[model samples]
Target: NAGVTQTPKFRVLKTGQSMTLLCAQDMNHEYMYWYRQDPGMGLRLIHYSVGEGTTAKGEVPDGYNVSRLKKQNFLLGLESAAPSQTSVYFCASSYVIGAGRNTGELFFGEGSRLTVL
Candidate 1:
């Protein structure tokens, strides 16, 4: 089973176009997250879902939306793609811990590259 996979390995978007990047996982994880990594910037959380049918805004959620309609899929939507939104996006997942130490074990998928101009 594929741990995690993202569609459209690369994409170019016009200033105001829209698109949805799909992320799928087979691990049955309880937590899923979307992050954007840019030059000189560490990974910043965009949106996250603790489980199916639940969603939450993250650090940089102004220009993004997310949905977890299915247990195996998490979708990130850009209503109006902008140059500021042009960054490498990564989808990650992990198991839920009641309370534990920091293992720092985050599973990341091959990122999706997007260019908005």
Candidate 2:
């Protein structure tokens, strides 16, 4: 089974265009996250969900929105794409260890690279 999967794999957009990225997991994880990676900045959280139907903004959520309509899927949307929003996005999921705690080992999907001009 695919532990985690990300769609489009790659995309290119012009400024102001909009698109959505899809992520799916089959491990029944209760926690899911969206992150973006830049050249030297590592990865930055864009949004996350603690459980199905619950979503919250992360560190770099400014240019993105996310939804967790079902336990096994997460969706990230860009309302209006911008050049600065271009980056390699990653989707991850893991089990919640204890209340507010995590094992720190996340299952990651193959990255989705998006570029905006």
Most lDDT-accurate candidate? 2
Candidates in order have lDDT scores of: 0.92, 0.95
Q: Candidate 1, residue 46: CA error in Å? A: 0.3
Shift in Å, residue 5, candidate 2: 0.3
Model 1 per-residue lDDT at 2: 83
Against the true structure, what is each candidate's TM-score? 0.93, 0.95
For all candidates, the clash counts are: 0, 0
Q: What's the residue-level lDDT of 95 in candidate 1? A: 80
Alpha-carbon runs more than 4 Å astray in model 2:
98-101
Model 2 alpha-carbon miss at residue 117, Å = 1.1
